[model samples]
Target: MTMKKLERFALIAMAALGAAACASVPTYVSLDPSLPRAQLTFHKGYEGTGLFSSAVQNYALGADEYCDSAKHAALFKNVSGTESALRVTPDVRTVVWAFTTYLNSTIGAGGVLGRYDDCRNAVIFTPARNRNYDIRQASTNGDAQCSLVITDAATGAAVRNVEVRASPDCIPRTKAARGSNR
Candidate 1:
């Protein structure tokens, strides 16, 4: 091989090795297992509010409730806030992933040259919310099943339906009961 080609190959190999060596083991933060509790909190915020009413109507008609303006507004607000918090929380796996992504994007070659290594880590560590499957189950069992309607507070239009679920338990089972039916 030509000297130039050999030099380029060496540089590429060195870069790959450096990245691997520098890459820290991604941490993960389990979602709040109390899905019921989280759903309750989410539901309470939607009650008596017209912001989600239209969205509820859409869901009833087999349409996408996310299209409702009121529901979208509420979702955007809540999700944005939650995402912001996740970015800053210390010792949190989600935060670490976010930080790593940010570094890769801004510090590295815009995260295009290298795959997004932290994407999965961030998702795994993200906190639980009413939108999650487990949280949805809790909401289905909670009062949300009965009071899922929401309306636009300003326009008095049915915006969407907010289903609140129950909180989840994060405790790990003991090894002795790991395989026991009872």
Candidate 2:
């Protein structure tokens, strides 16, 4: 082979090696078994109890397509506000993981892989009929249970039934600054 051709091949090989080296799957903590499992439903739009809105859902589906060969997982956290309604705070990093996992698996891998990507929506809880407080609060001493449901992005259907239990333990809170005056 010509000198120039050999150098070109070496460059290509280096680039491929670099790209492969940078390709890595992020790690996720195993779901907590002690937390109560909540049921999450994926809807076509923002009309119902689905975690993500239609636009977010579309993006998740796109991610699923783009990362079809990578493993992924999803994470959900709850944020507190003065309002009495139940609120869902979603972590985008977890959504990316879900997409990666779903994409890496073959079709119909079940909800286990797909549901990991459905962290786009926050499930809000409202008081039950004739109740004065949030249903979550009423049901469990103000502690709400969060659940994750995985589904196929292409068909908008469930892929598996791996139940993720949500408990107060999973919620992260901001710590007070040290050495600050009260």
Candidate 3:
């Protein structure tokens, strides 16, 4: 091949790699304070079967981080702006780990297992509020996205919603710093 052709090929390949490396997913968080108890819901975007497992894992982690931060913030608000150590429920951790493991599996299918496998909108939690609550998630688009919603237990009304795009590093360093106490 000519030198010019070889150089052009190299450039195209580099551009493709760069684009893949820069890909990031969006996450959402919502909080409701109308009720007396607190509820948090997390949503993770769907990925194609062709995407790497690590990339999917990163997206899930980003969603978890969003929930983590919001959960803490809710407690702080409940306590009149006083911060405390954060602890995640075993069920929440298990759901996240299980989802990530499925993504890493050879049959992950990018969560496209039909109606049951549609992971574009997953209600990460209903949480243990004083009253019985139901939290559900639904995907509006096929693009990658993750979201978390928190609500008040008594009134079952939303308090806040935060949407964050998941980059390679995911959450900001400052959020990580704030979570150090946990």
Q: Which stretches of candidate 1 lie over 4 Å from their true place?
A: 1-22, 35-128, 132-182
Highest lDDT: give the candidate number: 3
Per-residue alpha-carbon lDDT of model 1 for 1-182, expressed as tens digits? Answer: 44455444444543553345334322222335542311111121212212111111101010111111111111111112221111112222211111111111112344223222211111122223332211111121112233232333344454233322231112244556555723
Per-model TM-score, in order, reads 0.16, 0.17, 0.23
Worst 10 residues of 3 by lDDT: 70-79
- Per-model C-alpha lDDT, please? 0.23, 0.25, 0.30
| lDDT at 112, model 2 | 19
Tens-place lDDT per residue, model 2, 81-144, is 2222111222211221111111111123342121222222222131122212111111111123
Which residue runs of candidate 3 sit more than 4 Å off their true CA positions? 1-137, 141-147, 160-182
Which candidate, 1 or 2, has the higher TM-score?
Answer: 2
Better of 1 and 3 by TM-score: 3
**In candidate 2, which residue ranges exceed 4 Å CA deviation?**
1-23, 37-182
In model 2, which range of ten residues has the least summed lDDT? 97-106
Per-residue CA lDDT of candidate 3, range 134-177, in tens?
A: 22232222334434333443576863332322332223446566
